[model samples]
Target: MMMTGSALTDEAAEAETLVHSTKTDKPRRIAILSYRSTPHVGGQGIYLDYLSRALVERGHDVDIISGPPYPEVDERVKVIEIPSLDLYAQPHNGHFALRPRHFKRGEDLYEYFAHLTGKFAEPLTFGERLKRYFAEQKPQYDVIIDNQTLTPGLLSDALQKTPIIGIIHHPITQDRQLALDAEKSFRKRLLIRRWYGFIAPQIKVACQMPIHITSSGAIKKDIMREFGLKSEQLRVIPLGVAQEDFHPRDDVKREPLQIITTASADVPLKGLIYLLRAVAKLRDDLPDLKLKVIGKLREGATSKELEALSISDMVSFESGLTREELARAFCAASIAVTPSLYEGFGLPCAEAMSCGTPVLTTDGGALPEVVGDAGLVVPKADPEALATALRTFFKQSDELKAELGRRAFERAQLTFNWSRIAPVYETVIEEAIAR
Candidate 1:
């Protein structure tokens, strides 16, 4: 059941139940800090938004502290907005600096330059805001957990001592390595690496924290190896999917010979290029096959690859969709693919499965761990293997279609509902406070 109180209380209770609970006091206060929330941009934010709301449902108080691309939260949960220059707010065309976001000492300019230089600045800026917030008014919250804003400033600043915990979604190091491998030019690789350099502070800070948490052990392993951290330092907690929102839709028509994918269409780390090539190869065998992408199309290497492959005509791009529209897309899809080079948690794969759509995922980081036996698995950056899998799905359509969908639906129900997840988070909050 969905928690009715707040993220802190709900997850705290869930955590307690997972192990063994001896405490009688219910957790009252919770703080979840993140750089950006989703629907404003990506899945991380959506994860925070829904999970927080679910927590609130379970009778806990939740406050989300976030930077640019703020979260869309329920009225019950308090949102502490930490506004940045937000250069990447929307359509950041050439004339951004003079837009006048007023600066005490030109924090906006520094951020804009950082973006231009491919250096991520949100963690640093958010750290400054958080430090200021704590300095101005310190509240006696039961627990304070950061949602993947692993910057050193949060740990180093005076804000470090307040029953703090870190919620690392997953380390971004795997994304960096995949990107560097995908880069066509040495200069491109260098720029990508530079952008990822922002994670250094996160690595440094994880060492000192009493509680460090992640969504999956797959992710925990990755973070430990990449961040030079120890496995014992982290607590693994898997997040749940929103079954009601993601489940099968009988109203929507499932297009035959159609496939769907949800991710940034432009990012190289997502392996959109690999998917596109696979689609092209499969289209030759299944001549009427088509692909629909649910992410914004960008002018990047992946997009360029799509154009070069001559399969641009076969693919449909749609962005800026509400959750309902996205669900409709999932319902209409015959098969869903997650061709990422790496992932900490593959939300889309689970979401699609919840919608009763069969999934095919690449062995990119934690994707296989997430997909398990419910979906087909393939190698990363391999068009031939993907094409073969797609062809098999179509060739055995009648025999495997509903069977695959049924298995997927069952898996999603057992593992992904938000009601089930929110309480677990509540438990973690209590555990953190106890620590």
Candidate 2:
């Protein structure tokens, strides 16, 4: 009771050290690998950013090794940059242009040539660099989590020091099928097949992996079926949203007639074409309706569809928004829609729900699992069904919309928050280390 200030300070320091030591005793060293991890580019980057941060929060050291379009990771998470040709960043025809120095390295030469021939070779090239880095640096990690890269170089003798778990966010087979279905011309089909040639290597590496992690049961099933993996070899861990960052802001007023969707415009699997058709069908009845798309607007089938419907004026496109901007966009919208042909995990659906926005999504891949009963579900690739669902919502009263929003928010908080999901990842890593 009569202890001096110095004595009290010493006691507090000792208690802190004890707690830190206890947590550190079984703390793991984790390496998360990604070929292209630009956060705004796609879901894979977002997964890497959030998962690494969550793991670090749980008292593990996480290092992210990524190629160009590097991820914006937390300061606590170290990022190991792996340089590549990064042809995608080149302007105009620069992607096809090559320098004399590129011919020096086999990996760089392969990447440039692959791009010249309309093939995607980042995974292969990144893996080559990763294996080289491991051979030279010999970095120590308890487990290496490959974020859907599935490159053959990962299996090289240089990287056999640690257990590697591959994450297959659904199979690239689905994407190939959708892309092929979208095109009818013989030349186009041939080019599509050429671009997706990487799938073969992916399948080979996935089959070789001892353990695979997926985001949902749907994705696990696809991986098992496509890669011929056994049930026990796969682990399902659902992804999490930044609940605190995505939550509804009371100060932001929702636009009663505004609708938002986060689908890549040119990607056939994203089903943006169907969504555009649905919006066109609703244009007659809801004259004030406006749709905002969070993706790049490129010349493709999406553009043709918009032009054919003559509803281009009613839709606006915004790309590369910061996380805060995206959250605010969700909160300000009356409805958030996800009209994908398939998804390994419908991240935008969960994010919109976390922002207290009512959702309408197609029953594609894991959309039903992620949205549950909190959002409306329609058939995949059916524009009429999506239109009907949106019409029903437009006819509903504000009270019903508000109730749906509340349920969506609650569902997201209970199921998709990082705090709830990080422990599952921790357990998986521990099991890998144990093996």
Candidate 3:
């Protein structure tokens, strides 16, 4: 059940009093920094939204400082917007049409030139703006939580006034490598490298941070290796699902032949092309099979793959769904698949399980850690293995399917609930503050 504004504030106050009575320090005032935080854009936005709310529920004062395409944060949590060029949101080729007046500010000129050269400069530019913001306003916080905004400007003197802890979902080095591996052309590969040029600064900044947090042991290892940081410098704090929103609904009847996946279709790391291929292979045997994708059906590799496989009619796409809508989508599906090449933590896998849906996910990065033994596991980028897994599920009796779904829900309740995760985050924040 959703709590009203007064009730939420009262609960936070009580929790704060309880924490203050036990500890010397008052309730921590935290500032979470995100370069870009729009929920539908990527998992980072969702992470900020849920984490900020969860922290507030645990009696901490949380504020998200973000760039455009801002997150839909909880009402109780505050947001501080640090405006950017928002080049991606431009109607058409806005980067190429910049006027002479735009060159007045160094950041504006840098952002435009970077976009024109096919490079992502948001992280660097956001850090610069944030540094300036800190210098001008001198905001006070017990700790600053850097949400993967590993840029040199964050290391600037103006922003180093408070103790900072960084959360690295996963090293972007993996993303760059995967994209390069997927592309065959030399020019395209070069462009991909240039776009991911921020990784070098990210690595440098990450190594300099006193502490870094990740969602799973797998990601912890990746960050350590990628940034050349010691094991002790990194900590793993698993993410939580919103049980109130994603809980199972007995009233929602599941579609026996329906499969669902949440992914950004164009990104190679999401491995949507393989899932489509698997669906194409299964359609002959299970002609009624339908795949529902919770992402944009952009005219890219995914669309081309669907057209090439002649299975376009069997698939449907959805974007910008609210949590309630997404939960209903999970409950109505017979099974959910996460075919990512890698993930720091698979939020959709946990959400699907929370909705009492059996999940089939690749053994990518931290997916196995999230799925545990509650769902099916397959090798990454292997459409044949995914197809075989789907066929096996199709052969199962309804009774067995329902039983597996029950197990998935039970596992999520025990392991993925926010009630269980918030305390761990609080401990991490305390550690950062103490250091």
TM-score of each: 0.90, 0.93, 0.93
Question: Which regions in candidate 2 have their CA more than 4 angstroms from the true location?
Answer: 1-25, 93-96
| lDDT string, candidate 3, 319-416, tens digits | 98989999999999999999999988889999999999998888778887777667888889999989999998989999988888888898889777
Q: 1 or 3, which is superior by lDDT?
A: 3
Q: Clashes in candidate 2: how many?
A: 0
- C-alpha lDDT (0 to 100) for residue 231 of candidate 2: 78
Predictions in order: lDDT: 0.74, 0.85, 0.85
Per-candidate clashes come to 26, 0, 0
lDDT of 1 by residue, 1-435 (tens): 101111222322233356333332574677888877755466787788777887777777899888767788789988888777777654653235545545553556666777878888778777876777777777556777787787665765467666787877777777777677767898978898889878777778777776787766567777888887776677766667776678788799888988999875467668887889888887668888889998877877767778898888899888888778888898998999988877777788888988999888887766766666677888877877888888878888565887888877887786567666665666667766677
| Rank order (by TM-score, best first) | 3, 2, 1
Cα displacement (angstroms), candidate 1, residue 390, comes to 0.7
Backbone clash pairs in model 1 (N, Cα, C under 3 Å; residues 3+ apart or in different chains), count: 26
What's the lDDT for candidate 2? 0.85
